[model samples]
Target: MLESEYQNRRKPPRHLVPAAPSQAEFSYTLREATTEDLPSVLALYRHYVRNSVVTFDEKPPTLRAFRAQFEHTHKLGYPFVVAQSPSGDILGYARVQLFRDKAAFRHTVESTIYLGPASTGRGLGRALLTELIDRCEAAGIREMIAVIADSGAEASLALHEKLGFTETGRMGKVGYKFGRWIGIVMMQKSLRRK
Candidate 1:
């Protein structure tokens, strides 16, 4: 082949994935969630509850329960973030909640994140999770905990690991559903630099 032909045939540099919400590729914005976001949030949660082992519940939480979650988190001053498309579509959500009711556990919080099946694998999970960590740190939270179902270990575990969380405990046969018992992985991140 001629040198010019070879040069011209070389693949053009691939374009970057644009962020969501914009007409751009895969980009999105993370913002505080509101009650209006509950439907989409429940839809995503129910999708996994009904279709995957990501959660141990045999039945999805009711809309009433989800509303209570919003109220409870707000009362506790936890950060609830929604990953949104520029067009106002919610792609995913992440939040931090009090780890326990005991006084000694007040400085610690457990975090949870959920992404729509359509929104997974686009880096939205990581983005939302990192924001959860940031919000916890800013709130003087001393530790961030994650309770992961054994079957949901991949992305959730990897995301926590990337954010410096360490696996601290594992409880076998702690969750029962679908006529089966499942294990649990508990991970924690120290919010303080120390």
Candidate 2:
């Protein structure tokens, strides 16, 4: 299904329903991403590549490569979203990719999320993830999986757990980065009942 069609079918949680805002409240906007957001999105991922093992990549992909990835996900009818400040700064992004190539795996997706370095610890990640899950569920995705990079990634683990994901599996010492072997933790949440 096209994204716009899927969006029209989405039933956002009550808090996100459109209503005039009170002057005392502040809110961030979550919306479908465009190629124009790639530079900022790539920069955010680059920080993790150079300084952390959150992603296994040792080097950041070029902007062209990143744009190709964004397009591929969009073409598959999956959501690629960005969280923006009221002033329009791109604070973070989240998206889903095919969990595997097999035909039977079509109902599942792997999720990725990243925030600008300064945007951490402010609940933005949860907001992005929550919206992603909602959209996926609306589109009839049966499951969402998160392949967290390491067991030491407490914040990521906690965020997924808080959103009803459970640890499903782990591969010890499966990834080598930063001069050590890092483990992969697999977590999953069911989007719908059978």
- lDDT at 184 for candidate 1? 86
lDDT of 1 by residue, 35-147 (tens): 98898888888887887776877788999998997899888788999999888778899998778888899888888898877788888988999888888777778888899
C-alpha lDDT (0 to 100) for residue 102 of candidate 1: 88
Summed over model 1, clashes come to: 9
**Candidate 2: worst 10 consecutive residues by lDDT?**
19-28
RMSD of each: 6.1, 15.3
Pairs in steric clash, model 1:
18-25, 18-26, 18-27, 19-26, 19-27, 20-26, 20-27, 20-28, 21-86
Sum up the clashes in candidate 2. Answer: 0
- Of candidate 1, the 10-residue stretch with the lowest lDDT total is 15-24
lDDT of 2 by residue, 1-194 (tens): 99998987796877898897665434579999999988988888898899998899998999999898889888889988899888888889999999998989988999999988878888999999999999898878999999997745789999999999999999989889889999899999999632
Question: Where does model 2 exceed 4 Å of error?
Answer: 1-27
TM-score, per-candidate, Cα-based: 0.83, 0.83
